[model samples]
Target: MAEKLSSSPPARNIFQRLPLLGTGGVVLTMAIAVMGIVQGLRTISPWLRIGNNQAKAEISTLVVQQIRAVSELTTTIFAMETVVPTSQERQWGNFTLGRTDLLYIGYGEVRAGIDLAEINEQSIQQQGETLIVTLPPPQILDQKIDVERSRIYHYDRGFLNLGPDTVPELQTLAQRQTLAKITAAACDQGILNQANQKAEVALASLLKNTGHRQVEIKTTNPTVCAIPSAQGLSRDKING
Candidate 1:
């Protein structure tokens, strides 16, 4: 019997080792791909952070612009004049004259009459609102006086007369009427001034209130990022 050579361990072949080597290589490649992905994420984080900061800055700028716009609108409204009629002609009624045979009676009747006192009084109750003065109906003041009378007759039937005995009373009434008109005008002016002051005060109060509310919102409910940035994560890790 021929002595059989101990069979050497089956020679390892490149083909047989290929699958193992390829698997190892694939694992290494996967590790490198993972590392590259991590690096890419690290690099993009800073750009994302910059973009977020820019967005925040843009939002802050828009907020400021809106606030300025509101402020400007408030100021314009405050400076605007009320539409109330200030002219005397528009406030007062029309005047008419009638002549009689013996005496001429000049009657001043206002088509519309405005009572400033009433307006002012109403303003006391309704603050911060404009009040318009409206005139009432025209008041009639009649004056009759004799024009010509004959003296030849003992009982002089014809005589120059101005009007009835109430002519003096009418004159006095006219004076009072004129004075009242002047007083009303002054009162109206005062009321308008007071209303404007109140409006300004209200506007200031509104601005202050709005600012305080915004501050409270900022302090009590602070904004926080839902997902922390990579930089923030690095900072936390370093701190830890």
Candidate 2:
């Protein structure tokens, strides 16, 4: 007698009887929708940026006008570069077991300007078409190292070579040194004087826009633009 053959498995149906999405079609459709939404958002991102920037600038202008009046409508920004070296050592029984040594050629920038906020109604003198504004002494407004552009130019890990792993510490130390050095150098270069002169020109133009045809900005030099060490420090002997 012949034996009956076993029945084969049924083929999968590409389309199910369910409404709307069927056979995992909903997942595919949802993914496509999400991608389209993301693309649309990206296309409009630039406009959003422009709107935010304009709003911020407008707000800044209003606030400045209220606080500073028409005395200092502009500021002078100064930039400079400096290099700093950092070294640290771990010793055992008067013998150096590990040492981390690195030299960073840092690029730092600083801004100095006369504080217009110091100007009040008393500081402004009006005589016919001429307006005289007495500005406060210039000061260091901001200072920071450009970490993205500044980097290690040279390094020595000594014989043990433990520095490769502690690079973050070296970077932090270098940044601090670089800021101090750059600020000192800039001060020695008479950056305050430069800021004063530039500020005068900028304020004059700003005053013109505020209905003052002839504007004069004046300020006295401070007793100390920078500390005593600033003059002593230079690129040639910065390490000292």
Candidate 3:
């Protein structure tokens, strides 16, 4: 009789062979696998961080460009009427000959805003997922005296018209003075501060819409409000 052939057992894979190890060996093997996985993650971490940094940089650049395109962002307008009194006196050797008193009412407007064109990459910063934007100081954008709404409320050439015949000059002076006073008043009323606050709110909203979930808007202390020169003399003067 021919010898009967016996079938051999199938070979076990490494995973199947793991049970052949004692408890201590099994623990050691598992620990080594865990270490390998950790090592792989450690090696990949720096590249992931580098990628994140690059994306943040690109976002910052795009934000700056969008802000620059907005140009001047006017935030506040202060409008009011002020009474201005101007007088020209005629004198003769320390003795008052007469005085021309002009009482004028003037309406003026002061506009304040941020010049977005001044923003650049340096103005923006990234802190993790949050973005920080530093805005330029607010400035007096424009000052104007409304000639249509302004007029000479009272005029007197004191006592027999002894005062100088300077109607046009007095009116022009009143307009100029009105503009200066209005600008000063606006500054005192914290118009720049108001502009800064409004700008923050506006920018926060804008950046959020651009997919930035966390954003911080910051502003610098406003510089001295430089009153605009009297260039509106021709247009601001009241017709006498």
For TM-score, the strongest prediction is 3
lDDT of 2: 0.67
Q: What is the C-alpha lDDT of each candidate?
A: 0.30, 0.67, 0.85
Tens digits of per-residue lDDT for model 3 on 3-121?
33322223335556667666779789999999999999999998767666677778879999888888888999999899999999999999999999999999988989899988988
Lowest-sum lDDT 10-residue window in model 1: 76-85
TM-scores for the candidates? 0.27, 0.60, 0.71
Better of 1 and 2 by TM-score: 2
lDDT of 2 by residue, 40-80 (tens): 99999887676544544554465346547654433555566
lDDT ranking of the models: 3, 2, 1
- Report residue 83 deviation for candidate 2 (angstroms): 2.7
Off by over 4 Å in 3: 1-54, 228-240
Candidate 1 regions with alpha-carbon error over 4 angstroms: 1-9, 12-15, 51-53, 64-213, 216-240
- 1 or 3, which is superior by TM-score? 3
For model 2, the superposed segments whose C-alpha errors exceed 4 Å read 1-74, 162-165, 209-213, 226-240
Give the alpha carbon lDDT tens digit for every residue of 1-240 in model 1: 233343333334656888999999999999999999999999988866665445444544543443345432111111111111110111123632221122212121111111122222212111122212121211111111111211111111122432133433333333333323433333333433333344344434433433223221110111221222212222111111
